[model samples]
Target: MNQNRVQASEVAPRAGLADISILANASLTSVTGTDMTSNAQGNYDLALKYSGTGLASVGVADKKVLVYALPAELQGKVVGGATVDIDANLLPITPGDIPGVKVLFDALGVTINTLNAVLPIPSVVAAFNQLKTVQNLGAYQKTLPAVVSADGKTISVEFTQELSEYVHQAYVATFGSLRAAIDALQGGNVVTKPLIDGLKLAADKLFDVIELIASGGSDILDLALNGNILGDMNGTLHTTVSDPGAASATVKAGAINNALISADVLTAIEQEGEAVTLNFPTTAVNPIENYDVAAPVITQPVAGQTQVAGQVTLTQPIPDRTTFEAVVTLPDGSTKNVPLAADGTFVVDTGSLVDGQTISAKVVATNGTYTKDSPITTATVTAAPIENPIADYNVATPSVAPLTAGDPEITGQVTLNQPIPLGTTFEAVATLPDGSQLTGTVESDGTFKSAGVDQLAAGQTVTNG
Candidate 1:
């Protein structure tokens, strides 16, 4: 087994049903849909709805009802006495053939809902993006082998675990990781501020989920919270240092806030089967006032810069001398020290830049401490913009010819306007007297040809051919 690449069995995704009911802690506070359930008449009937329809969410809004497609090894594996397994390896792979292993859960309708976890308020883009990516991959399919009992009465279902199981393993593993990062970071107030801001952002999103589910959209909530990701980010966190290859440049990024968000409040609601809603005072609390952050700045060669890329540029609100140094690093991994310039400005030379190469730079004080300025890239230094004749092009101005008597197509090419590159294909179309049309390609000599003229009648053409 290759440790670097995940195995096939580990990645097989479990089929899913995407809807769920979010009842109040006990006695469903509200049924989102009309009457909650429909009858044979399809009329609303909460009592009947709960009894029938076999409609339940497996924790995803739009996934198919879960029917684990079994691999060969565990043909008759079962979980908690369910035996819907057919052999796929022995079954026909070609169309119209039943596979050897087929595992189906009996008319088992499930109510899938979100298990709210503390999402650090600050992980909007990165965390959400990761969630989306994981969804595409499908929570590592766990319905791998459906086991049957000796008497063929009881059953068990299990799957080869992957990194994903950790996602659902525990809230501590997920949320705890961020807590550890906050504790481990050294930038005093500077770094913690952004982290708090990120958490607050996540809180707002959680509130949105609460409202969506309470209003009959449990499936949407399921999608947002189903899979576990970024749950392993525990303990030590290294600073991300930006690199400036040749000359230095500066990048500015959003600040992190350290506002504390208690995820327990939200998760508790979810535990009780009640949707969580963020109810803030109407006056609103501005969490970011006086966010303490280190003004750590770095002086490094910019990324993707050439030998002559310009010198380092500092962003506004430069950090104090304590947080930043006055030197930059070149592409060769050598340092270009600054004289601790009074005005927070420094320079790098183009003579040190290399041609046909790219580089970047970042600002840090203690020889690779917390990064201050964002990294910036520069195009390779070159004598001039390289010109490639093959890449250049000219579009000839087109000429329009009015439809003539019984004319079915429009035809005109400007031979004198410009010389089109060789292998260029052009076309013109015409509508005949009848309502028909034609189209075709152009030739090297700038000549116009047409098709579909035959489709038009001599006196019945209406529009462009």
Candidate 2:
């Protein structure tokens, strides 16, 4: 016989939503009527009341977010034994209230619970043709407000509804395209190239989920109805991590990672950020369908490409690693095959290279394949790490000869002699007659590679390597 309280915000907007329609039909005076009750099944239901032209359009938001407990049917759910419902009738509006005002309420007494959203609240694919339009490209460039406002109130508990599978696919593809570049944004980590394809697959799998949400969100983000797209996203769960030995992991798409990212990851440049890891009770994570877009793709350059190093990129949605493959056809009709670096990247030394001849680039990746006719790149190679630029081995030795990233770029293996000073208990610095540089991460047994051995002073050799 206990009663729960639920209050609706008057001036709040949906979060992360850019464009939408609103439906306002009526207004309300007060929710003074008190009723103690059950749904005849003896279960408590949370009841809401409102009036005004708005009432006709105010569909309920999801009370139980994905990361949180179930809605009404599942245990540990928000409606936990209590039933929440909404009722409405016309009433004259006051000074602060409008012609159509809504009142959200909750009540309880029952025991069974399952998470069923009030509906209209939650839930993409691709084509190269659509890439031509600026508007089409901008469709996914929405800047969902970190927080939104409506009628004078801030919306805290909000979620994105009206998600499209096609759009989701597009976003995923785009992300996959940029998978290699993502490394530049996130803190340095050894990401296998395959993760890019996995992310796209994940994004594609979201179509089913998009359908589920689209079917139910009849009035969720309609601009004609609720003027603001932002929802009252209160008490929404964001992350889930589980022990590796669990039987299964029921990680949902919206399942958030409070530790890694939140609403912030939705960006183009992709600066330093975190990852969202989900956990389930099972040994492997069960897939929860969701929607996102697939980014574009650009093959490398051609032979006659004016001396500039050409590159390939992607934009995928999944966080798993992926492999990317590309083929280069030389001017003489010979083809040179290449694979992405450890983290889905590839590099070519164009230095001793020539131009003015037609060349082509071929790419076959996890998602699909792309071919560029007569593509061209240049012979503009940047300086690799400094080679043995250190001096004074007799007085003071250095930690590393060339101290920068992107050298020995593929293996990440380095070679450095004992940079120790006096050569007593510590290792001795190898002094070459020519005087160049050398060094990298030395393993327990004392073996490493120099950073920029590729571009070095002629005739300088390190005994360590």
Candidate 3:
């Protein structure tokens, strides 16, 4: 009842035929007497009675046939009317215990003999080894579990889904190597049509025997295993290949035509259902054409001169300006693109640059593949002018006055020696006899009015500051 351990009941109820017909090419008429019995080891033995004209014609000494092994889940339990389900999960025949496997393999060897006529192919020898690996059931038994009797008449078949896949891969590997060998021989023009055609038929026959064993003696080969088994190679083989003729080209200024790069085309040849590309040699062609582009000339913001108001204006006439754009480098070492006007002139605003700082400009032109830069044109940044408004203004002395309680204010006048800034103003301070000072204001009309001076005495002079 344990799932991992297969039971005798599981084996007996499922597959009842111990010896099944694996030689599908040989016609089988009937298989009867499915009296199956099992041991404690969960091994099932079936004494089947088989009747077939083709089976009798083989004259194989061993009468026992290959049989399918039940999967773990379908071992014991029987489902009524679900034969398809059982058939689908059944494993392939036990390769090691098949009665006439050697006989079947010998028959396949006969087919291989025709291919051996063209013997020097190393790949073909490799394919022969691969085919032999498929034939040696003992090699497969190393991985596939089997219980063979001492006399080799009874075999407890234990196979899984992997058997089908392993057999398929083996046969595919054989044909692939065989095809490679054939193509190599064909390329040398040594292999002929009759030889290749005979080899193809022989390959198919060998595949038929392997597939029958993989399918547990069934005539139906799985469609999954039938895909491009022979590499889909068909049609008449082409032995001789035509030589590819010479290639040609033309050169022009600044460009070369791409169509003339290759002088000849190497025709592809088909061998063993695959296309073989031939290597054809040709003379080398240089496609580069020699040429040169003239440098653009810079005309304005003359080199080594002060730029007006920190603005560097670069100018070029249409005839002299052939570049796409002009770049200006500022005193701070920053560069920016200067958009050229329709008249080919551009202005760079260096904005309030310090004294002795410089700005430079150059034209960049490209003719698709090559770029050229004209000689850099540079100019100095202009400095700001100094202002001295105080030096232009002058003030006159104030009037002497005797201090009286009733009238104590003094008046004064100021003069402008030259034009000064519009917002300029002047102030006056007077020291009386008491050592105290009186402060006064000056107007735009050059008039000065002082604060009250009630402490001033006779002969005390008031000085203007």
Q: How many pairs collide in each candidate, listed in order? A: 94, 129, 4
Candidate 1 lDDT by residue in tens digits, 291-323: 232232333333334332233334434322224
lDDT of 1 at 120: 33
Candidate 3, residue 118: the lDDT equals 56
Q: What is the C-alpha lDDT of each candidate?
A: 0.30, 0.28, 0.38
In order of appearance, the predictions have TM-scores of 0.20, 0.17, 0.23
Q: Candidate 2's error at 81, in angstroms? A: 31
lDDT of 2 by residue, 331-442 (tens): 5566666775544445443333343444555444442122222224322222334445345444223333432332342122333445654422323233333575443555
Model 2 spans with C-alpha error above 4 angstroms: 1-237, 240-308, 316-319, 323-326, 332-347, 350-358, 364-465
Worst 10 residues of 1 by lDDT: 104-113
Model 1, residue 253: C-alpha shift (Å): 59
The Cα RMSD of model 2 versus the native structure comes to 34.2
